[model samples]
Target: MQKISQKSIHKYLRHDKKFPHVWCPGCSNGIVLGAVIRAIAELDLKKDNIAMVSGIGCSSRMPVYADFNTLHSLHGRAIAYATGVKMYKPEMDVVVITGDGDATAIGGNHFIHAARRNIDLTVILINNYIYGMTGGQYSPTTPHGDKATTTPYGNIDPTFDICKLAIGAGATFVARTSAYHAVETQSFIKQAFKHKGFSLVEIISACPVIYGRLNKKGDAPTMMKQMKDDVIPIKQYEKLSPEQRVNKQTRGIFINDTEKMEYTLAYQELIDSLKVPKGDSNE
Candidate 1:
């Protein structure tokens, strides 16, 4: 029963005073960070036994700020690196943090395969629809026909629903939420950590500096307000008509199926079935 704060996490981290964080103002990355930290604190996970890995992006910088064993890895390979770490050290609570571009653009292959494997890991994907750190390029999550520096005329490219992708790729737990809903976002993250199989929480955050300026989504406050107006709670959504729900928002635990076997356990089962002789130390 520890509170998540600078003092509480200081003992577990390498550097404390050096962090108000380097992320831009009005960024949802901070909220996401707070949610994850809160979740870890709530779970009472040992900092020594937790590993956070990240790829290159604004969101990828998360591991650097977290008070845990961490790896700041190459672009688009956070999940792959995390999977390897978990496979070797199955006791670690491995969390992978990456942006939309880092996760789905260059990292698309790795992302899908990780989901397919159903590895015991929690993936926190912060999807803000543009490359925030690298001058606002259009990303895989960019809405169709939205403007970005790379898509000045209009995007015309389809945006990927990350939660749906994770679910379809075979992740055992999949959920989605916006940075606007801090409480719900934290709740989903906590649940994802508790789930034994591959779990994914696709956080739809607002990037006012990049996405808003380009897509005319307005300022940070405006973008947040849009989320508040658009995201329909699960309870209220259930009461809505089919017509009313069309093209409308719905946010909740979209999928939760724990029956799926995790990769580590499954691989162990395969080895057991093979009956490989235990006598080989180096033979």
Candidate 2:
């Protein structure tokens, strides 16, 4: 891929209309947005050919700032909306931007079923471990014993391994990365766009104002450093002993299956199969 510049990325953003994004001072959503823009620019994709759909959340606010064919739908319905866009115009690249609560909590069914159907949609799930925009509530991916507005003492719920869920749900392309690793995140996004079936890139992001403050995870910089230290590449993580792997997360592609037919393509094939021959007439 050709090298991208900060100035070039501006072309993809609605900076003139949506200046000064709404994310917190130390939030990681900006980093993820940068990665997304860079990925699209690197691919040289036409803005008209891409449909960016998002649900209600801080992350969902991204599409409003982007210059693509965009949709800001209801909470937990980004995937469903994106699916419709993909089905109607299978030639367009549909990207779904969603948050932990928006995607896995209220939208878990949509997320899983999209994977099961193997539709060609790139899902960028930003896992911040808490409901940042709504409140300081604990989310599905919140770590066990973590503090939150709802769990003042500590949360006892076990966290969801997003990558594992996507793989098990049959997403043809599954990968994990953090906001700190901007280059890797962009690379994974590019890969997801190229994949033929359901593609999920779960980006572990930071919500320093809410989740970090409640959990005593320090400021945004500290949280970013923690992300750098806590997550190891999948290849290196595989070499660690069981004990060493504890409390650690792995980054890298978990699966990329090319055999399964994409839902849109399969549906088109079915439509074609039902069509009568050009010269044949059935009385």
Candidate 3:
């Protein structure tokens, strides 16, 4: 793969209009954005052919900065809008930028159904544990014992394993990586873009301002270092004993099923089947 330079990826950004992004200093959203830009640059995809869709959240602000056909949609509705875009213009590459609360909470139904249909869309779900943008509420993926503004004492809810959820929902391509692992994240995203059906990349991101301050996870660099230590490669994780695997997160492609037919193609096939022969139309 060719090395991507910061200058090269600038063309993909709306630098003049969206300069000084809204994300907090040291927020991993920027890291994810860099990975995404690098991946698109590596793929050599046209800017016009890509559509960046986002819902409400800090991560969801990505579409505002990207120069692609961007759609900043309602809370938890990025997938729904992306599905419409894909159905209407199946040729365009639709990428959804969403956060933990925005994706697995109110948007849960849309997320599952889209995966169940196996539509052609790339969903980059940034899991930052708490609802960083909406006042640090505990999200669907917040750890059971984590502290959030909503859960002052501590959370009692079990966290959702995003990759497993996607796989169970019938997404053809599912992967997980952290913002700390930029190279791996970029590689997975590239693979997701190339996949023909529903693809999800769950990126473990950091919200140092809110989630970090609440959970005492330390500064952004410390959190990133912890991620480097905690998330292991899937191959290495599989080799570990059950006891050894405790509290460890694995990063890598979890699923890539190429056999299932894409939703748009199937819909088009159904449309073609319904059409009567050219000379055999009912009078």
Better of 1 and 3 by lDDT: 3
RMSD of each: 3.6, 1.6, 1.9
List clashing residue pairs in candidate 1.
145-156
Candidate 1 — worst ten consecutive residues by lDDT sum? Answer: 1-10
By TM-score, the best candidate is 2
Task: TM-score each candidate.
Answer: 0.89, 0.97, 0.96
Task: Sort every candidate by TM-score, greatest first.
Answer: 2, 3, 1
Model 1 lDDT, full chain set? 0.87
Rank candidates by lDDT, best first: 3, 2, 1
Q: Please give the CA lDDT of all the candidate structures.
A: 0.87, 0.92, 0.93
lDDT of 1 at 2: 42
On TM-score, the stronger of 1 and 3 is 3
Off by over 4 Å in 2: 280-283
Q: Which of the two, 2 or 3, has more TM-score?
A: 2
The TM-score measured for candidate 1 stands at 0.89
